[model samples]
Target: MHVLCTAGHVDHGKSTLVRALTGMEPDRYAEEHRRGMTLDLGFAWTTLPGPGAVAFVDVPGHERFVSTMLAGAGPVPAALFVVAADEGWMPQSAEHADALAAAGLRHGLLVISRADLLDPELARDDARAELAARGLGSWPAVAVSGRTGEGLDALRTAIAELVAGLPAPDPDAAVRMWVDRAFTVRGSGTVVTGTLGTGTVHRGQELELDGAGGRIAVTVRAVQELGEPVETATGVARVALNLRGLPREKVRRGDALLDPHAWPSVVEADVRLHGIGGPAQVPDSPVGLTLHAGSAAVPVRVRPLGDDVVRLRPDRPLPLRIGDRAVLRDPGAHRVVAGLTVLDPQPPALRRRGAARRRAGTLAAASGVPDAAGELSRRGAVRTGDLVRWGVPGPEVAALAARVPTAAGWLLDPTRATEAAEALDRAVAAHDAADPLDPGIPLAEARRAAGLPDVALVAVALDRAGDGAPGGPVVRDGRVVRAGDDGPPAAVLDAARQLHADLTAAPFAAPDADRLAALGLGPRELAALERAGELLRLTPDVALLPDAPDRAVEVLRGLGPEFTLSAARQALGTSRRVAVPLLELLGRRGRTLRTPEGTHRLR
Candidate 1:
């Protein structure tokens, strides 16, 4: 299926051309028929010989309704640009032509309508010249009379040929259908109609509706195409979705139904305007304009970056991507101000005084194409999925495997990898200097020190630093450790050795707080010795050898299976304070069990 929108001046017979081709009325409102002019968007479709089904979105062409015309034409890929023979080229014709060019529409058929009223050959030549001036000279022209049906067959054939040659859209792409017509059906609830440009929509598929009120989850209760209910609908086809979990008032004509996880609602972006050698010029900085894209017309504040580049900050968040074409209109003048091609949907902030001017130079050099490596380099690192949402194709992201390194589902720039590795080395050295007893840095702290987003990236930085290199950073257990370094400093180790000697000589003589402090064992040093398996801490102050519990159990077994705390202390030759917690620690280790009466037995 193929969908095309009608564009031309008001009363240029755009709707008439659609009616003649489809044998269906293009105008839906009574006011439109009574006034004999298109006031809003009208929809009709017909089955072509080779194209299967071709849908037409008839848009109003009056200068007042240019916004309405853009809403219809923005999402459709091709167009049926109509111009009456009697009125070869009109004001709305130039505006619509500029709009279509601004929309980046390359596939279309120029229809010279009402040929019976005048000689269409002359009109066709004149219309072709006018279109050429507006950058649409490549489209095929057809002379047809919608009233008398003159040359209708040729027009249909031209449309079929134009649609058959259009670039195929990916049915597997992410869905981002803009709602051109949204209303409530009698019993089906809210129904939104739009031309699906890519991806497929199926019944029961959950989607996110992004609008002025922010994002909300909605389910597709049903899908319909050409007035027939269907299990699924693909791109380049007109679809009417019966949506559940939303009211008619909430779903507006400008809202979009997007794959919930595939789009990011953004408010600011850097863009290349069709400024130089084009019909429109970039407006001055901080000027108010209406940005039209994909059936959405949002008020925006434009900051002129260069002669042809700008940064647009929309009043509301929009689902935008790089390379997407949009129109910027001066709402006060009611005319197109500029046409834009998005360069960066996720632009950096212009905080410094000259940042905007400097950024303009950078954007001028950008290719305005989806570049995974370029984006990754700009951000240093980003989620793989985020690049996809930024308009980089999944295949391109996968192909970046050789150019970019991924850690914890994030793509890391080569330069950033080097920076993070150096950061890791500094962090390890700092941590070791600050606390020699426990030198290895915690993984979370290492991630922060390296300025990496994820803790898992610390390992990647370690690997980048040549993890096992002599004295280089490496991860031991869960902490980031320096390579080739044995335990604590020599002085701390000497103190630990003396403590070990004391504990070995008297197996159960746990050191008191003052004694341990005298031996230079603080909480940190003691915990380090404990982690090294050299000592066991029965309490904050009481210390013992790692095997003291085993030797104590043997001594208690000599006193029979059960013994009182006092008897145990006497047997172990330790004081009551040290004996109390030691007995409790033995029970906790399951080497001994405590009776209800507070006597203990070996387990």
Candidate 2:
């Protein structure tokens, strides 16, 4: 189903056009009919030949009800822009035109209503020129007289063609039903009517309803599409939901029923305005303006972030997504002050000194509008929960999660991930060079060196680098490095090899510092060997073979799980300098069960 909204000047025959098309009166209240002006909003639907079912959200054309018009127009992508032939062009026509263009609406039928009252062709030409000036053009134009039924057939055909050509709605997209009307139906509780802009809404579904009061849980007790009860209703259609646990007063015209997981609500956002080049030049001192987004408009304070981007903090949290278009209006002047496209819903706080200027640069770059992954990379890493908060659509984040690795709830950008991987390699190499006789640097230190957002990503970066050829920086066991790095530097290669062989052969006895210094393998060379996993040191003087602990375990197992210190010494054939620590190492590994009396048993 497709939903189209009407736009025109006051008393320009918008409601009359809708009534002619749908054979139902659009004005619901007696006051509206008697006054011949739509004070709120009205809805009517009909079936088109090839496009199936369609609904028309009849919006008020009076300047007094401009906000009501914005509420009706936000969710409906297609429009039936009505202009009375006799009037040609009017004041409200321009305001409505600004609203449509601001919303980025591109599909519709331009109607010359009450054409019998004027020369149809000339009026159409004038209307077309006026619309083009407002940045709206190329829609099929038709002359129609609702009272006389003149040219209604051509109008229908044009509407059908427009709806047929509209981009297909994504049923799997997140549901954001912008409620424009709410009421009570006796025992039915609160019945809210809205345009289901995307995704599908089903009966008995629980969703987050975001409004002035913030988010609250609501259930759809029943759903009606085009006046018929249905289990589900897809986007681009009008839906009335019988809601449970919400008062009619709480379900206001601007409230939104949304997918709790997909549609996150925010009170403030940074946006780039279109048409007028950018949002109205809001000042450092905030000013009140109406912010229109998704069948909702709330009073907001506008502040300029840059020439092209402005920050809007609404009176309440709103369900917003990147690329969603909105209109900013000065109610006093009844003029479209600006038209905005959401750039960042969760903008960085400008609390630090010079943060505003720095963020202005980011906003400038964002105006180029990269895709989801590119934005993520530019930010380095974003908390998974904040993807939508930054105005990225939830569906995009979900798709990205499948493609990228999310470690510890942050989506690591592919480019930044590569940089971090290289950084990790460099940090390990630097540590090994400075402290030659130690294992790899701690994960915390690596994270700090790379300026990583989380320590979890340190391990992830190495895992992604994969195991290298026997002796690369990839030599990681848990958080420690098993120093089998490619090889030590040219200056220490000979000394490093000699130290390794000496430690391997001796297994239990480590050479003294004086002996190490004499061999030209100082503290650094020893640390480097340890990083390469070629040398294992139990103490400053006692370097042991890598397999020494396991060998001790084997001998102790054969000794019937009971042995004294001297007995263990004889088994390993080493003195207490090596035996004591080795025995402790064995006990620590759970290979030997040490009793309170000091006897050791096989664990």
**lDDT scores in order:** 0.86, 0.78
- For 1-603, candidate 1 gives per-residue lDDT tens digits of 999999895873878888888989989888988888899999999998988899999999889899999999999999988888898888888888878887788788889899999988887888788778767889999999988999999988998899889999999999999999998888889999999999999999999999999999999999999999999999989999999978999988889999997987888999998842354466765766899989999988888887778889999999998889998887787677767888998888899998988988877677779898888877778888888998999988988855666777887877887898888888888878988888788888888888888987777766765746888888778888877868777887899899889888888787777888899988888888776677788876678888887888888888987889889999999998778988888888898887888788888
Residue 511: error of model 2 in Å? Answer: 18
Q: In model 1, which runs have C-alpha deviations exceeding 4 angstroms?
A: 121-126, 279-282, 303-309, 348-365, 399-404, 434-438, 527-534, 549-564, 583-602
Question: Each candidate: how many clashes?
Answer: 0, 12
How much RMSD separates candidate 2 from the native structure?
Answer: 5.8
The most accurate candidate by lDDT is: 1
TM-score of 1: 0.90
Each candidate's root-mean-square deviation in Å? 2.9, 5.8
lDDT of 2 by residue, 16-66 (tens): 888899998888899988888888788898998998898998899989888
